[model samples]
Target: MKGRATGGLIVALLTLMLAACTVVDLDADGKPIMPKDPNAKPGYSNQTPQQIAESGWASRVQQPAEQQALSWADMETKSHTVKAGASESVFVRAGGVVTAFDNSNARERHLTMTINGKPVQVQIGPVLRSNAIRDAAGFRFDEFTNQVQYAQLTKALNRHAVKQLPAVDASWVGKPVQALLAVTMAPGKVDDVVAIQLQQGSP
Candidate 1:
Protein backbone atom coordinates (compact mmCIF):
# COMPACT_ATOMS: atom_id res chain seq x y z
CA MET A 1 0.00 0.00 0.00
CA LYS A 2 2.94 2.37 0.72
CA GLY A 3 4.43 1.80 -2.76
CA ARG A 4 0.96 2.57 -4.30
CA ALA A 5 0.75 5.85 -2.30
CA THR A 6 4.28 6.86 -3.38
CA GLY A 7 3.37 6.21 -7.00
CA GLY A 8 0.25 8.46 -6.64
CA LEU A 9 2.35 11.33 -5.22
CA ILE A 10 4.85 11.11 -8.11
CA VAL A 11 1.96 11.42 -10.63
CA ALA A 12 0.58 14.50 -8.92
CA LEU A 13 4.05 16.23 -8.85
CA LEU A 14 4.59 15.52 -12.55
CA THR A 15 1.17 17.03 -13.40
CA LEU A 16 2.03 20.24 -11.51
CA MET A 17 5.40 20.57 -13.30
CA LEU A 18 3.75 20.11 -16.67
CA ALA A 19 1.19 22.83 -15.85
CA ALA A 20 3.98 25.27 -14.87
CA CYS A 21 5.98 24.54 -18.04
CA THR A 22 2.93 25.09 -20.33
CA VAL A 23 3.16 28.37 -22.33
CA VAL A 24 -0.57 29.38 -22.10
CA ASP A 25 -1.32 33.17 -22.39
CA LEU A 26 -2.55 33.30 -18.79
CA ASP A 27 -1.79 35.53 -15.74
CA ALA A 28 0.53 34.44 -12.87
CA ASP A 29 -2.52 32.94 -11.14
CA GLY A 30 -3.27 30.85 -14.30
CA LYS A 31 -6.40 32.93 -15.15
CA PRO A 32 -6.78 34.20 -18.74
CA ILE A 33 -5.40 37.80 -19.14
CA MET A 34 -7.78 40.27 -20.86
CA PRO A 35 -7.02 43.23 -23.14
CA LYS A 36 -7.35 46.79 -21.79
CA ASP A 37 -10.68 48.59 -22.31
CA PRO A 38 -10.37 51.06 -25.21
CA ASN A 39 -13.33 53.22 -24.02
CA ALA A 40 -11.97 53.74 -20.49
CA LYS A 41 -11.31 57.36 -19.46
CA PRO A 42 -7.68 58.37 -18.96
CA GLY A 43 -6.50 59.26 -15.44
CA TYR A 44 -3.53 61.26 -14.17
CA SER A 45 -1.39 58.81 -12.34
CA ASN A 46 0.88 61.79 -11.49
CA GLN A 47 -1.17 64.82 -10.18
CA THR A 48 -2.94 64.89 -6.83
CA PRO A 49 -6.72 65.77 -6.70
CA GLN A 50 -6.24 69.26 -5.13
CA GLN A 51 -3.85 70.45 -7.86
CA ILE A 52 -6.33 69.58 -10.61
CA ALA A 53 -9.22 71.55 -9.02
CA GLU A 54 -7.15 74.71 -8.37
CA SER A 55 -5.69 74.77 -11.89
CA GLY A 56 -9.15 74.48 -13.44
CA TRP A 57 -10.63 77.33 -11.36
CA ALA A 58 -7.69 79.66 -11.93
CA SER A 59 -8.02 79.48 -15.73
CA ARG A 60 -11.75 80.41 -15.60
CA VAL A 61 -11.50 83.40 -13.19
CA GLN A 62 -11.25 87.09 -14.39
CA GLN A 63 -7.94 88.94 -14.58
CA PRO A 64 -6.87 91.62 -12.03
CA ALA A 65 -8.56 95.11 -11.89
CA GLU A 66 -5.76 97.26 -13.39
CA GLN A 67 -6.18 95.74 -16.87
CA GLN A 68 -9.99 96.09 -16.75
CA ALA A 69 -11.11 99.74 -17.28
CA LEU A 70 -9.82 102.82 -19.20
CA SER A 71 -7.30 105.00 -17.31
CA TRP A 72 -8.45 107.01 -14.25
CA ALA A 73 -10.10 110.30 -15.39
CA ASP A 74 -8.27 112.79 -13.09
CA MET A 75 -4.91 111.25 -13.83
CA GLU A 76 -5.61 111.21 -17.57
CA THR A 77 -6.41 114.98 -17.88
CA LYS A 78 -3.06 116.23 -16.53
CA SER A 79 -1.02 114.79 -19.43
CA HIS A 80 -2.48 116.95 -22.25
CA THR A 81 -1.17 120.52 -23.04
CA VAL A 82 -3.38 122.73 -25.21
CA LYS A 83 -2.43 122.60 -28.91
CA ALA A 84 -1.12 125.65 -30.87
CA GLY A 85 -3.47 127.98 -32.90
CA ALA A 86 -6.64 127.08 -30.99
CA SER A 87 -9.27 129.48 -32.52
CA GLU A 88 -9.90 131.18 -29.15
CA SER A 89 -7.72 130.97 -26.04
CA VAL A 90 -9.32 133.55 -23.70
CA PHE A 91 -10.14 132.33 -20.19
CA VAL A 92 -13.75 133.20 -19.44
CA ARG A 93 -15.18 132.73 -15.91
CA ALA A 94 -18.90 132.76 -16.60
CA GLY A 95 -22.36 131.70 -15.29
CA GLY A 96 -21.78 131.41 -11.51
CA VAL A 97 -18.85 128.89 -11.35
CA VAL A 98 -18.25 127.73 -14.95
CA THR A 99 -14.85 128.60 -16.51
CA ALA A 100 -14.25 128.50 -20.27
CA PHE A 101 -10.96 128.85 -22.20
CA ASP A 102 -12.10 128.58 -25.82
CA ASN A 103 -10.32 128.53 -29.25
CA SER A 104 -12.64 128.53 -32.21
CA ASN A 105 -12.95 129.25 -35.96
CA ALA A 106 -15.67 129.05 -38.65
CA ARG A 107 -14.90 125.33 -39.09
CA GLU A 108 -14.84 124.11 -35.43
CA ARG A 109 -14.27 125.13 -31.79
CA HIS A 110 -11.68 123.54 -29.58
CA LEU A 111 -12.25 124.18 -25.87
CA THR A 112 -10.23 123.77 -22.66
CA MET A 113 -12.41 123.89 -19.59
CA THR A 114 -11.97 123.51 -15.80
CA ILE A 115 -15.14 122.95 -13.80
CA ASN A 116 -14.97 122.64 -10.02
CA GLY A 117 -11.44 121.17 -10.29
CA LYS A 118 -11.85 118.71 -13.21
CA PRO A 119 -10.30 119.48 -16.62
CA VAL A 120 -11.64 118.49 -20.11
CA GLN A 121 -11.08 119.56 -23.73
CA VAL A 122 -13.11 119.00 -26.91
CA GLN A 123 -13.20 119.63 -30.68
CA ILE A 124 -16.67 120.31 -32.04
CA GLY A 125 -16.59 118.71 -35.47
CA PRO A 126 -19.08 119.63 -38.25
CA VAL A 127 -22.26 118.08 -36.88
CA LEU A 128 -25.60 119.89 -36.58
CA ARG A 129 -27.92 119.85 -33.58
CA SER A 130 -31.40 121.42 -33.86
CA ASN A 131 -31.21 122.82 -30.32
CA ALA A 132 -28.38 121.92 -27.95
CA ILE A 133 -28.32 122.80 -24.27
CA ARG A 134 -25.28 123.91 -22.21
CA ASP A 135 -26.01 124.02 -18.50
CA ALA A 136 -24.17 125.63 -15.54
CA ALA A 137 -24.58 122.68 -13.14
CA GLY A 138 -24.64 119.26 -14.82
CA PHE A 139 -22.55 116.37 -16.24
CA ARG A 140 -22.78 117.93 -19.73
CA PHE A 141 -20.92 121.00 -18.44
CA ASP A 142 -18.09 118.74 -17.32
CA GLU A 143 -17.53 117.61 -20.92
CA PHE A 144 -16.93 121.22 -22.02
CA THR A 145 -14.28 121.76 -19.30
CA ASN A 146 -11.49 119.41 -20.40
CA GLN A 147 -10.28 118.96 -23.98
CA VAL A 148 -9.18 115.34 -23.72
CA GLN A 149 -12.27 114.35 -21.74
CA TYR A 150 -14.65 116.25 -24.02
CA ALA A 151 -13.11 114.91 -27.24
CA GLN A 152 -13.30 111.38 -25.94
CA LEU A 153 -16.86 111.83 -24.64
CA THR A 154 -18.15 113.57 -27.80
CA LYS A 155 -16.42 111.06 -30.04
CA ALA A 156 -18.24 108.28 -28.21
CA LEU A 157 -21.60 110.06 -28.48
CA ASN A 158 -21.13 110.98 -32.14
CA ARG A 159 -20.01 107.50 -33.03
CA HIS A 160 -23.18 106.14 -31.45
CA ALA A 161 -25.33 108.63 -33.37
CA VAL A 162 -23.47 107.99 -36.60
CA LYS A 163 -24.11 104.31 -36.34
CA GLN A 164 -27.87 104.91 -35.95
CA LEU A 165 -28.13 107.70 -38.55
CA PRO A 166 -28.95 106.89 -42.17
CA ALA A 167 -25.90 106.46 -44.45
CA VAL A 168 -27.47 108.48 -47.32
CA ASP A 169 -27.80 111.72 -45.30
CA ALA A 170 -25.03 113.86 -46.84
CA SER A 171 -25.69 116.87 -44.58
CA TRP A 172 -24.94 114.76 -41.50
CA VAL A 173 -21.43 113.86 -42.70
CA GLY A 174 -19.54 117.17 -43.27
CA LYS A 175 -21.93 120.04 -42.47
CA PRO A 176 -20.32 122.95 -40.57
CA VAL A 177 -22.16 124.05 -37.44
CA GLN A 178 -21.94 126.28 -34.36
CA ALA A 179 -19.99 124.63 -31.53
CA LEU A 180 -19.81 125.80 -27.87
CA LEU A 181 -17.61 124.28 -25.19
CA ALA A 182 -18.23 125.34 -21.57
CA VAL A 183 -16.75 124.40 -18.20
CA THR A 184 -18.50 124.27 -14.83
CA MET A 185 -16.64 124.10 -11.52
CA ALA A 186 -19.08 123.48 -8.71
CA PRO A 187 -18.50 122.41 -5.07
CA GLY A 188 -16.82 118.98 -5.07
CA LYS A 189 -17.36 118.50 -8.83
CA VAL A 190 -15.73 119.65 -12.09
CA ASP A 191 -17.31 119.21 -15.58
CA ASP A 192 -17.13 120.28 -19.26
CA VAL A 193 -19.91 120.45 -21.89
CA VAL A 194 -19.79 120.85 -25.69
CA ALA A 195 -22.85 122.24 -27.49
CA ILE A 196 -23.21 121.98 -31.29
CA GLN A 197 -25.70 123.77 -33.59
CA LEU A 198 -25.95 123.12 -37.32
CA GLN A 199 -28.03 126.17 -38.44
CA GLN A 200 -25.65 128.75 -36.92
CA GLY A 201 -21.88 129.25 -37.18
CA SER A 202 -19.42 128.37 -34.39
CA PRO A 203 -20.66 129.60 -30.94
Candidate 2:
Protein backbone atom coordinates (compact mmCIF):
# COMPACT_ATOMS: atom_id res chain seq x y z
CA MET A 1 0.00 0.00 0.00
CA LYS A 2 2.88 2.44 0.80
CA GLY A 3 4.50 1.71 -2.59
CA ARG A 4 1.16 2.29 -4.34
CA ALA A 5 0.79 5.67 -2.59
CA THR A 6 4.32 6.75 -3.59
CA GLY A 7 3.59 5.89 -7.24
CA GLY A 8 0.38 7.95 -7.15
CA LEU A 9 2.26 10.91 -5.66
CA ILE A 10 4.90 10.70 -8.36
CA VAL A 11 2.19 10.65 -11.02
CA ALA A 12 0.62 13.76 -9.47
CA LEU A 13 3.99 15.59 -9.49
CA LEU A 14 4.57 14.68 -13.13
CA THR A 15 1.08 15.96 -14.02
CA LEU A 16 1.78 19.24 -12.25
CA MET A 17 5.06 19.64 -14.10
CA LEU A 18 3.36 19.03 -17.42
CA ALA A 19 0.69 21.61 -16.60
CA ALA A 20 3.35 24.17 -15.74
CA CYS A 21 5.06 23.68 -19.10
CA THR A 22 1.87 24.21 -21.14
CA VAL A 23 0.67 27.60 -22.37
CA VAL A 24 -2.99 28.62 -22.47
CA ASP A 25 -4.72 30.88 -24.98
CA LEU A 26 -8.20 32.33 -24.82
CA ASP A 27 -10.50 33.96 -27.39
CA ALA A 28 -12.59 37.07 -26.76
CA ASP A 29 -15.45 34.95 -25.41
CA GLY A 30 -13.05 33.12 -23.03
CA LYS A 31 -12.92 29.95 -25.09
CA PRO A 32 -9.53 28.17 -25.14
CA ILE A 33 -7.51 28.42 -28.37
CA MET A 34 -4.14 27.19 -29.57
CA PRO A 35 -1.20 29.16 -28.29
CA LYS A 36 1.16 30.82 -30.76
CA ASP A 37 4.76 29.67 -31.08
CA PRO A 38 7.01 31.48 -28.68
CA ASN A 39 9.96 31.33 -31.08
CA ALA A 40 8.29 33.15 -33.95
CA LYS A 41 9.84 36.40 -35.23
CA PRO A 42 8.37 39.63 -33.96
CA GLY A 43 6.51 41.98 -36.32
CA TYR A 44 7.60 45.55 -37.04
CA SER A 45 4.07 47.05 -36.89
CA ASN A 46 4.53 47.97 -33.27
CA GLN A 47 7.93 49.57 -33.78
CA THR A 48 8.38 53.31 -34.27
CA PRO A 49 10.09 54.93 -37.25
CA GLN A 50 13.16 55.59 -35.17
CA GLN A 51 13.41 51.96 -34.17
CA ILE A 52 13.20 50.82 -37.77
CA ALA A 53 15.94 53.22 -38.78
CA GLU A 54 18.25 51.75 -36.16
CA SER A 55 17.59 48.12 -37.02
CA GLY A 56 20.44 45.84 -38.17
CA TRP A 57 18.68 45.11 -41.45
CA ALA A 58 18.63 48.81 -42.30
CA SER A 59 22.39 48.86 -42.89
CA ARG A 60 22.27 46.03 -45.41
CA VAL A 61 20.17 47.81 -47.99
CA GLN A 62 21.82 48.82 -51.30
CA GLN A 63 23.03 52.38 -51.73
CA PRO A 64 22.34 54.60 -54.74
CA ALA A 65 24.68 54.45 -57.73
CA GLU A 66 26.78 57.36 -58.93
CA GLN A 67 25.25 59.27 -61.85
CA GLN A 68 26.61 61.42 -64.71
CA ALA A 69 26.74 65.18 -64.29
CA LEU A 70 23.63 67.23 -65.06
CA SER A 71 23.60 70.31 -67.30
CA TRP A 72 22.55 73.33 -65.21
CA ALA A 73 23.51 75.71 -68.04
CA ASP A 74 21.02 73.99 -70.32
CA MET A 75 18.36 74.16 -67.60
CA GLU A 76 19.01 77.88 -67.23
CA THR A 77 18.72 78.37 -71.01
CA LYS A 78 15.27 76.73 -71.04
CA SER A 79 14.14 78.77 -68.03
CA HIS A 80 14.49 82.00 -70.09
CA THR A 81 11.39 81.37 -72.24
CA VAL A 82 8.91 80.14 -69.60
CA LYS A 83 5.88 82.51 -69.48
CA ALA A 84 4.61 83.24 -66.01
CA GLY A 85 0.79 83.06 -65.77
CA ALA A 86 -0.51 79.56 -65.29
CA SER A 87 1.82 76.97 -63.76
CA GLU A 88 4.08 75.34 -66.34
CA SER A 89 5.82 71.99 -65.72
CA VAL A 90 9.45 71.86 -66.87
CA PHE A 91 11.19 68.49 -66.77
CA VAL A 92 14.69 68.73 -65.27
CA ARG A 93 16.70 65.54 -65.41
CA ALA A 94 19.48 65.73 -62.84
CA GLY A 95 21.84 63.20 -61.32
CA GLY A 96 23.35 63.53 -57.86
CA VAL A 97 23.13 62.46 -54.23
CA VAL A 98 21.38 64.24 -51.40
CA THR A 99 23.88 66.11 -49.29
CA ALA A 100 21.58 67.55 -46.68
CA PHE A 101 17.91 67.46 -45.63
CA ASP A 102 16.75 70.21 -43.31
CA ASN A 103 13.71 69.43 -41.13
CA SER A 104 14.18 72.26 -38.67
CA ASN A 105 10.98 74.06 -39.63
CA ALA A 106 7.77 72.94 -38.01
CA ARG A 107 5.90 73.14 -41.33
CA GLU A 108 8.26 72.55 -44.23
CA ARG A 109 11.07 70.12 -44.95
CA HIS A 110 13.84 71.04 -47.40
CA LEU A 111 16.61 68.98 -48.97
CA THR A 112 19.73 69.83 -50.95
CA MET A 113 21.34 67.57 -53.56
CA THR A 114 24.64 68.11 -55.34
CA ILE A 115 24.68 68.11 -59.14
CA ASN A 116 28.21 68.41 -60.55
CA GLY A 117 29.24 69.35 -57.02
CA LYS A 118 26.86 72.29 -57.00
CA PRO A 119 24.25 72.31 -54.25
CA VAL A 120 20.64 72.95 -55.26
CA GLN A 121 17.46 72.80 -53.20
CA VAL A 122 14.69 70.40 -54.20
CA GLN A 123 11.63 72.66 -54.39
CA ILE A 124 8.29 71.60 -53.04
CA GLY A 125 4.82 73.19 -53.40
CA PRO A 126 2.82 75.64 -55.55
CA VAL A 127 4.48 78.06 -57.93
CA LEU A 128 3.25 81.64 -57.75
CA ARG A 129 1.65 83.20 -60.87
CA SER A 130 3.15 86.52 -61.95
CA ASN A 131 2.44 88.71 -65.00
CA ALA A 132 5.69 90.73 -65.06
CA ILE A 133 8.04 90.13 -68.01
CA ARG A 134 11.34 88.85 -66.73
CA ASP A 135 14.11 86.45 -67.76
CA ALA A 136 13.25 82.79 -67.21
CA ALA A 137 14.90 81.48 -64.03
CA GLY A 138 16.14 78.09 -62.91
CA PHE A 139 14.26 76.29 -60.10
CA ARG A 140 15.14 76.49 -56.46
CA PHE A 141 13.92 74.38 -53.54
CA ASP A 142 12.53 77.11 -51.31
CA GLU A 143 14.34 77.40 -47.98
CA PHE A 144 11.34 78.33 -45.89
CA THR A 145 8.84 75.48 -45.63
CA ASN A 146 6.19 74.57 -43.05
CA GLN A 147 5.04 71.16 -41.83
CA VAL A 148 2.03 71.22 -44.15
CA GLN A 149 4.40 71.81 -47.07
CA TYR A 150 6.66 68.97 -45.99
CA ALA A 151 3.73 66.52 -45.98
CA GLN A 152 2.89 67.50 -49.54
CA LEU A 153 6.51 67.01 -50.57
CA THR A 154 6.63 63.52 -49.09
CA LYS A 155 3.45 62.52 -50.92
CA ALA A 156 5.05 63.56 -54.22
CA LEU A 157 8.26 61.73 -53.36
CA ASN A 158 6.31 58.52 -52.71
CA ARG A 159 5.02 58.48 -56.27
CA HIS A 160 8.55 57.94 -57.62
CA ALA A 161 9.12 54.74 -59.60
CA VAL A 162 12.01 53.84 -57.33
CA LYS A 163 11.45 53.75 -53.61
CA GLN A 164 13.59 56.39 -51.97
CA LEU A 165 15.48 55.66 -48.81
CA PRO A 166 13.90 57.17 -45.73
CA ALA A 167 15.05 60.67 -44.80
CA VAL A 168 14.86 59.98 -41.11
CA ASP A 169 17.21 62.38 -39.36
CA ALA A 170 20.31 62.49 -41.62
CA SER A 171 20.33 58.98 -43.03
CA TRP A 172 20.05 60.31 -46.58
CA VAL A 173 23.34 62.20 -46.39
CA GLY A 174 25.98 61.27 -48.99
CA LYS A 175 23.56 58.84 -50.65
CA PRO A 176 23.75 59.07 -54.45
CA VAL A 177 20.36 59.63 -56.06
CA GLN A 178 18.76 60.90 -59.25
CA ALA A 179 15.40 62.45 -60.05
CA LEU A 180 13.16 63.69 -62.86
CA LEU A 181 12.16 67.01 -61.40
CA ALA A 182 8.95 68.78 -62.40
CA VAL A 183 9.97 72.42 -62.05
CA THR A 184 7.40 75.21 -61.81
CA MET A 185 8.34 78.42 -63.59
CA ALA A 186 7.04 81.85 -62.56
CA PRO A 187 8.05 85.34 -63.58
CA GLY A 188 10.91 87.05 -61.66
CA LYS A 189 11.41 84.15 -59.24
CA VAL A 190 13.47 81.00 -59.21
CA ASP A 191 11.79 77.91 -60.63
CA ASP A 192 10.06 75.78 -58.00
CA VAL A 193 10.18 71.98 -57.89
CA VAL A 194 6.55 70.89 -57.58
CA ALA A 195 7.13 67.20 -58.14
CA ILE A 196 9.92 64.58 -58.26
CA GLN A 197 10.51 61.01 -59.45
CA LEU A 198 13.46 59.53 -57.56
CA GLN A 199 15.45 57.10 -59.70
CA GLN A 200 17.48 54.06 -58.64
CA GLY A 201 20.23 53.58 -61.27
CA SER A 202 22.04 56.37 -63.13
CA PRO A 203 19.79 58.68 -65.17
Candidate 3:
Protein backbone atom coordinates (compact mmCIF):
# COMPACT_ATOMS: atom_id res chain seq x y z
CA MET A 1 0.00 0.00 0.00
CA LYS A 2 2.81 2.40 0.96
CA GLY A 3 4.70 1.50 -2.28
CA ARG A 4 1.58 2.31 -4.39
CA ALA A 5 1.16 5.66 -2.57
CA THR A 6 4.81 6.61 -3.22
CA GLY A 7 4.48 5.77 -6.95
CA GLY A 8 1.29 7.87 -7.23
CA LEU A 9 3.02 10.95 -5.73
CA ILE A 10 5.92 10.58 -8.22
CA VAL A 11 3.43 10.32 -11.13
CA ALA A 12 1.60 13.47 -10.00
CA LEU A 13 4.87 15.42 -9.74
CA LEU A 14 5.99 14.24 -13.19
CA THR A 15 2.65 15.23 -14.71
CA LEU A 16 2.92 18.73 -13.20
CA MET A 17 6.50 19.13 -14.49
CA LEU A 18 5.46 18.19 -18.03
CA ALA A 19 2.52 20.60 -17.88
CA ALA A 20 4.79 23.46 -16.79
CA CYS A 21 7.24 22.83 -19.62
CA THR A 22 4.47 22.78 -22.21
CA VAL A 23 3.10 26.14 -21.03
CA VAL A 24 6.44 27.98 -21.01
CA ASP A 25 8.52 28.76 -24.11
CA LEU A 26 11.96 30.16 -23.46
CA ASP A 27 14.56 31.57 -25.83
CA ALA A 28 18.32 30.90 -25.75
CA ASP A 29 18.91 33.46 -22.99
CA GLY A 30 16.01 32.14 -20.86
CA LYS A 31 13.53 34.89 -21.73
CA PRO A 32 9.95 34.13 -22.72
CA ILE A 33 9.55 33.75 -26.51
CA MET A 34 6.45 35.25 -28.16
CA PRO A 35 4.56 32.80 -30.36
CA LYS A 36 4.95 33.43 -34.14
CA ASP A 37 2.31 31.40 -35.96
CA PRO A 38 0.02 33.92 -37.68
CA ASN A 39 -2.66 31.49 -38.76
CA ALA A 40 -3.15 30.08 -35.29
CA LYS A 41 -3.26 33.66 -34.07
CA PRO A 42 -6.52 35.53 -34.59
CA GLY A 43 -6.80 38.58 -36.94
CA TYR A 44 -3.58 37.90 -38.90
CA SER A 45 -3.27 36.03 -42.20
CA ASN A 46 -1.55 32.72 -42.73
CA GLN A 47 0.34 34.13 -45.75
CA THR A 48 4.13 34.17 -46.03
CA PRO A 49 6.01 37.42 -45.45
CA GLN A 50 6.45 38.20 -49.17
CA GLN A 51 2.84 37.38 -49.92
CA ILE A 52 1.62 39.43 -46.99
CA ALA A 53 3.71 42.38 -48.13
CA GLU A 54 2.35 42.37 -51.70
CA SER A 55 -0.82 44.31 -50.87
CA GLY A 56 -1.88 47.51 -49.03
CA TRP A 57 1.29 48.19 -46.93
CA ALA A 58 2.33 50.99 -49.31
CA SER A 59 -1.00 52.82 -49.18
CA ARG A 60 -1.21 52.46 -45.40
CA VAL A 61 2.20 54.09 -44.92
CA GLN A 62 1.85 56.65 -47.73
CA GLN A 63 -1.49 58.06 -46.60
CA PRO A 64 -0.22 59.09 -43.18
CA ALA A 65 3.09 60.43 -44.50
CA GLU A 66 1.52 62.66 -47.16
CA GLN A 67 -1.19 64.01 -44.86
CA GLN A 68 1.00 64.76 -41.82
CA ALA A 69 4.16 65.95 -43.60
CA LEU A 70 5.71 69.12 -42.16
CA SER A 71 8.31 71.45 -43.57
CA TRP A 72 11.71 71.50 -41.88
CA ALA A 73 11.14 75.02 -40.60
CA ASP A 74 7.67 74.24 -39.31
CA MET A 75 8.76 70.90 -37.84
CA GLU A 76 11.48 72.63 -35.87
CA THR A 77 8.93 74.99 -34.35
CA LYS A 78 6.03 72.66 -33.55
CA SER A 79 5.48 70.24 -30.67
CA HIS A 80 4.36 67.41 -32.94
CA THR A 81 3.56 64.01 -31.46
CA VAL A 82 2.10 61.07 -33.42
CA LYS A 83 0.97 58.15 -31.30
CA ALA A 84 1.78 54.50 -32.14
CA GLY A 85 0.61 52.37 -29.28
CA ALA A 86 2.74 53.64 -26.36
CA SER A 87 5.31 55.41 -28.56
CA GLU A 88 5.30 58.64 -30.65
CA SER A 89 6.95 59.96 -33.89
CA VAL A 90 6.65 62.59 -36.62
CA PHE A 91 6.81 63.19 -40.40
CA VAL A 92 8.67 65.82 -42.44
CA ARG A 93 8.41 66.99 -46.04
CA ALA A 94 11.28 69.39 -46.54
CA GLY A 95 14.45 70.19 -48.39
CA GLY A 96 17.95 69.93 -46.98
CA VAL A 97 21.54 70.03 -48.25
CA VAL A 98 23.37 66.71 -48.36
CA THR A 99 26.26 67.34 -46.00
CA ALA A 100 27.91 63.91 -46.09
CA PHE A 101 27.51 60.17 -46.66
CA ASP A 102 28.11 57.18 -44.39
CA ASN A 103 27.58 54.47 -47.01
CA SER A 104 30.97 52.78 -46.49
CA ASN A 105 29.65 50.26 -43.93
CA ALA A 106 26.74 49.36 -46.25
CA ARG A 107 24.66 47.82 -43.48
CA GLU A 108 24.60 51.07 -41.45
CA ARG A 109 24.21 53.31 -44.50
CA HIS A 110 22.94 56.90 -44.08
CA LEU A 111 23.70 60.49 -45.08
CA THR A 112 23.87 63.83 -43.32
CA MET A 113 21.37 66.34 -44.66
CA THR A 114 21.52 69.83 -43.19
CA ILE A 115 18.21 71.55 -42.70
CA ASN A 116 18.16 75.23 -41.70
CA GLY A 117 21.85 75.03 -40.70
CA LYS A 118 21.33 71.94 -38.53
CA PRO A 119 22.59 68.52 -39.66
CA VAL A 120 19.84 65.88 -39.93
CA GLN A 121 21.04 62.33 -40.57
CA VAL A 122 18.75 60.57 -43.05
CA GLN A 123 18.86 56.84 -43.69
CA ILE A 124 19.52 55.93 -47.36
CA GLY A 125 19.52 52.22 -47.05
CA PRO A 126 20.63 49.22 -48.90
CA VAL A 127 19.68 48.05 -45.36
CA LEU A 128 17.24 49.82 -43.04
CA ARG A 129 17.26 49.43 -39.24
CA SER A 130 13.96 51.00 -38.20
CA ASN A 131 10.46 51.04 -39.65
CA ALA A 132 9.85 54.70 -38.80
CA ILE A 133 7.52 55.35 -41.76
CA ARG A 134 5.26 52.46 -40.81
CA ASP A 135 5.47 53.07 -37.08
CA ALA A 136 4.73 56.76 -37.54
CA ALA A 137 1.33 55.74 -38.93
CA GLY A 138 0.28 54.67 -35.42
CA PHE A 139 -0.73 51.06 -36.10
CA ARG A 140 -1.91 49.34 -32.95
CA PHE A 141 0.29 46.62 -31.49
CA ASP A 142 -2.45 44.20 -30.44
CA GLU A 143 -3.63 44.03 -34.07
CA PHE A 144 -0.88 41.52 -34.79
CA THR A 145 -0.08 38.28 -33.03
CA ASN A 146 3.72 38.26 -32.89
CA GLN A 147 7.03 39.79 -33.99
CA VAL A 148 7.10 37.68 -37.18
CA GLN A 149 3.99 39.33 -38.62
CA TYR A 150 5.15 42.76 -37.40
CA ALA A 151 8.66 42.43 -38.84
CA GLN A 152 7.47 41.08 -42.19
CA LEU A 153 5.32 44.16 -42.64
CA THR A 154 8.31 46.34 -41.78
CA LYS A 155 10.55 44.51 -44.26
CA ALA A 156 8.02 45.07 -47.03
CA LEU A 157 7.66 48.76 -46.28
CA ASN A 158 11.41 49.21 -46.17
CA ARG A 159 11.76 47.58 -49.60
CA HIS A 160 9.22 49.93 -51.20
CA ALA A 161 10.53 53.05 -49.43
CA VAL A 162 14.12 52.35 -50.45
CA LYS A 163 13.14 52.14 -54.11
CA GLN A 164 12.00 55.78 -53.99
CA LEU A 165 15.47 57.10 -53.00
CA PRO A 166 17.53 59.19 -55.40
CA ALA A 167 20.48 57.55 -57.12
CA VAL A 168 23.04 58.96 -54.69
CA ASP A 169 26.70 58.68 -53.86
CA ALA A 170 29.56 60.93 -52.71
CA SER A 171 28.54 63.16 -55.62
CA TRP A 172 25.32 64.13 -53.85
CA VAL A 173 27.12 65.98 -51.07
CA GLY A 174 26.66 69.79 -51.02
CA LYS A 175 23.57 69.48 -53.29
CA PRO A 176 19.99 70.27 -52.25
CA VAL A 177 17.63 67.31 -51.81
CA GLN A 178 14.01 67.05 -50.74
CA ALA A 179 12.24 64.10 -49.16
CA LEU A 180 9.32 62.98 -47.03
CA LEU A 181 10.72 61.58 -43.77
CA ALA A 182 9.47 59.66 -40.75
CA VAL A 183 11.34 60.29 -37.54
CA THR A 184 11.06 60.06 -33.79
CA MET A 185 9.71 63.18 -32.07
CA ALA A 186 12.21 65.92 -31.05
CA PRO A 187 14.64 68.25 -32.85
CA GLY A 188 17.53 66.13 -31.62
CA LYS A 189 16.16 63.24 -33.71
CA VAL A 190 15.42 65.58 -36.60
CA ASP A 191 19.04 64.68 -37.24
CA ASP A 192 18.15 60.97 -37.30
CA VAL A 193 15.32 60.22 -39.74
CA VAL A 194 15.43 56.61 -40.54
CA ALA A 195 13.99 55.20 -43.77
CA ILE A 196 13.42 58.17 -46.04
CA GLN A 197 11.27 58.56 -49.21
CA LEU A 198 12.69 61.15 -51.59
CA GLN A 199 12.18 63.91 -54.14
CA GLN A 200 15.55 64.28 -55.87
CA GLY A 201 17.23 67.14 -57.82
CA SER A 202 17.42 70.90 -57.12
CA PRO A 203 15.20 71.60 -54.08
Best by TM-score: 3
> Distance from true position, residue 134, model 1, in Å?
24
Tens digits of lDDT, candidate 3, 89-187: 567787888889888887667888887887888887867777676677665456566787877777766777777676778887888887788775643
Report how far off residue 5 is in candidate 2 (Å). 99
Per-residue lDDT, model 3, residue 176, is 82
- The alpha-carbon lDDT assigned to residue 118 of candidate 1 equals 44
lDDT per residue (tens digit) for residues 98-194 in model 1 = 2342434534444333333444443343342211111211123232435544334333433332233222222322332222222232332333333
**Model number with the top lDDT:** 3
> How accurate locally, in lDDT, is each candidate?
0.33, 0.47, 0.70
Model 2, position 84: C-alpha lDDT score: 57
> lDDT by residue for model 2 over 1-203, one digit each (tens)?
99999999999999999988867778899988876569855443444323432341223111111122124556556556667565443445677888897766623455688876678776422221221111112212242134444334333332331233233346766777766554545543345542234544465
TM-score of 2: 0.39
Q: Which sequence of candidate numbers ranks them by TM-score, best first? A: 3, 2, 1
In candidate 3, stretches whose alpha carbon ends up further than 4 angstroms from where it belongs are 1-43, 77-87, 186-191
Q: How many backbone clashes does candidate 3 have?
A: 1
- lDDT (Cα) of model 2: 0.47
- Compute each candidate's TM-score over C-alphas: 0.18, 0.39, 0.66
Lowest summed lDDT across 10 adjacent residues in model 2 is found at 131-140
